[model samples]
Target: MSYKGPEPRRYPTAPWGAGDSATAVESGKLPAIRPIWDVHIRDTIVCLGGDGFYYMTGTTGDNCWAFNDGVELWRSRDLKTWGYLGLVWSIDRDGTWEKNWTARAGVPFRALWAPEIHFIGGNYYICHCISGVGIGVLRSTTQRPEGPYAHVLSDQPIKGGIDSTLFEDDDGKVYLSWGAGQRIREIKPDFSDFAGDWQDLAFDDSGIDPKAKKNGQPLRRVGFEGATFFKANGKYYAGACNKDEGRYSFWFASSDKLLGPYAGRHEGPPGGGGGNLFRDKAGRWWQTFFGNDDQMPFREKPGLIAVEFDAAGHVVASADQPFKPFA
Candidate 1:
């Protein structure tokens, strides 16, 4: 099942035209939402670095489903103005086990998907998955966000799944979860390997997604793909992408404990699937966006939406959401 197709473009040029930049909506303009960068990306994630900048990266490339080079990145100071850092990690150059291509459903592809940047323990870490392969974590050799990144696990994937995300708990223990948050395991403190056995995460009120069913029965899970995990307000939140009534959306479940019997499945931020939630420097909550459905304001461009947790501990888009696509 190796990729035998023509050599795809390595680090395809971003479609940004002259004078274009990664600019956010004007400050203090509560409801004026706009795309940060008018470039193609999916699984958008933004993380605030210890050096006082926000780093953004995701599934990039012209035809990511077929092939692409590696992880691309951009940085912002106040989440307003951004500057590109170019391809920080390349498959053909830096990858050891990750360099091999594989076929998915009879189609040969070798693209990186959903590479999320996390500033954990004063260093940057990226967890990503290859299209038909498994997931791996990379650490910045120089402790910078744009790194000469090397594998945390040198010769193998950390797990076999997609949309892998890392969560650092209050006690400083980091855990890895993936495949729509269906399975989770703690990573060793040194980022070398898994620390324990895989644990299943369940939702007490998991509902069936009409679009995703088996045997004519609806499938119940947090989401079909693009898993995101974070801790906010002392509760562990696990989120993933799902289609709600044909609209790509973000769904989440919360648990008092890390390995939940997480309760309740609720949709947050309509048209905001395949992205993660993050807090800005001012401690304001926001969710990444890359419109993936027809009903959205735009498609395949990186955006952001203001969000806040409800009284019941559910993440919900704020009334003053900067980008109200559904409105």
Candidate 2:
């Protein structure tokens, strides 16, 4: 099947979808991330696949407020030009079980939301949130990035929460985290079920509530979500976003242990668009996010920014150009 959406942009240089044009037009040194045309709101998960290609995914459902479509799968090599792989999973895919719960809970009307894709155990596993109650898991047995991933959790194993994140530790243990001050769960080896009880995280909270309403107007939300946890410098850092409150900021908290006694901090400027902070194959770090909210018009464009560390160990994200000037 083929997708008819935003064709990658026609750069000043030449040719659309022609031979190696993306890599050939590289802006070397800095992390180069261009718009994944017609894509929006999907989680920005950038990881190098075991197959020697760089991969990423976005929630495609962001357009539903106006378009009514659901999630679609995507992959890229140079992080510039992206391919609309296929719709591996969606909320309205014929007889989706999520329809049952959404109809009952009154949230089914909401479009398909935040999704995450990861290359794990030589298999590609993806997770999607069911309104904010739980998450559905999907798996692809094949070796390709554009997966015909099967829903592993049609019944849905996540006990609760949305904007869920799937994380694998150094020991190969997988954990799921989401919502505000969410619990982290360890998944069984087979990815068939969640193991044991959920654990609470220790956060040195400084962010505001993203869902808070004021006297007459809704206050800008600053509460945390999109908790992308990863290991670096031999420690675990929970990289997450704080939306609205003033502007979008990517905040992080670090700890020696996987579950933490942590202090959270936010990156400024190209702040605003909440995203995932991940490392590429060459050891360089980058943060990828979409332009959202009144940040519409910019809805279909996703931006990538370079992240660097200071001598003091602070992660300073470069949000200068190409990236919408938010703050």
Q: Which candidate is the best by lDDT?
A: 1
The TM-scores, one per candidate, come to: 0.86, 0.73
Those runs of model 2 whose alpha carbons end farther than 4 Å from true positions after fitting are 1-42, 65-69, 101-108, 205-222, 293-300, 318-327
Model 1: worst 10 consecutive residues (lDDT sum): 20-29
Candidate 1, residues 174-256, lDDT tens digits: the string is 98887788887888888887788888776665454444456665334678888888889988888888876566778888899
Tell me model 1's lDDT, rounded to 2 decimals: 0.78
lDDT of each: 0.78, 0.57
**Across residues 1-327, which tens digit of lDDT does each residue of candidate 2 receive?**
122233322212211222222221132322334455545444556667787677666555423432224446666777666776667655556325555433323322344456677888888877666563566677775756666666664455445666777888988998877765346888888877778678977655444243333554432222467667777787777766665434345566667787775554544324324456777777777777554432222333566777766654557655444433334
Candidate 2, lDDT over the whole model? 0.57
Q: After superposition, how far is residue 271 of candidate 1 from its true place, in Å?
A: 2.0
